[model samples]
Target: MIDTTRLLSGHREGSTLPPLSLDVTKPGNWVVFGPELTAAAGPWGMSFSANLTPDETTGIGSWTEDVFIKTLRTGKHLGMDTGRSILPPMPWYEDLKAVFAYLHSLPPVKNQVPGPVPPDQVMKMLSTQ
Candidate 1:
């Protein structure tokens, strides 16, 4: 879970993260997420906005607060040995307990995010300079 206020503020201000073209000024768009990108595109691939809802089978329902903090602090998926490093556009260094608390407060939603795949050399060449 991310602190939407901070993340959106960064986006709005054009901070280090990639610029978000989405118009955040519109009412009710605060919940609006993104257009998912594939990892095969390269290190810069921007995956879809995660299903922050706590569905046990699909979302973060099973994750503990420690894992959440570890994920942000270390940028590793699952915040453990078995997962991959957290990808780009996620400012994993900034861990906000309020974000995790908010996530915990939400009703679980079963949204199965697509698994990321490794990029081939061709895609690597095409997407990156």
Candidate 2:
């Protein structure tokens, strides 16, 4: 027997990981050729996951496909232009083929990624349990 209430409760708290600041997902919870998405959001440590949307401030809500391609392909957010590096588990160089292919196949929805994981806080995140 499925405990509907318990299941729902689990979702409320167990929906994401233990280290992000916000929850970033597209409508329908469907990611085309998605990148690295931890089960739960990380704690609001020194850094948080970018919304990964196209929004100006909160999301990647204003980028071009070409730019997006480079960001993931090189794992250098904005391709060295921004002079910042995306954190680990982004799978930019690792699983890019699928990420690119899937993203290309999905509808271009404007979502915003939250703030970034500051360099100072990056190491702490790695050591966090």
Candidate 2 RMSD computed on C-alpha atoms after optimal superposition onto the true structure: 17.4
**What TM-score fits each model?**
0.39, 0.37
Q: What clash count goes with each model?
A: 0, 28
Prediction 1 global C-alpha lDDT: 0.56
Residue 6, candidate 1: alpha-carbon lDDT: 38
Q: What lDDT score belongs to each candidate, Candidate 1 first?
A: 0.56, 0.53
- Top candidate (TM-score): 1
Query: Mind giving the per-residue lDDT tens digits that candidate 2 earns over 1-129?
Result: 554443322123324334422333323332221122233322211223455645576556577788888888777877666657765345567786787898899988898985788869978876994
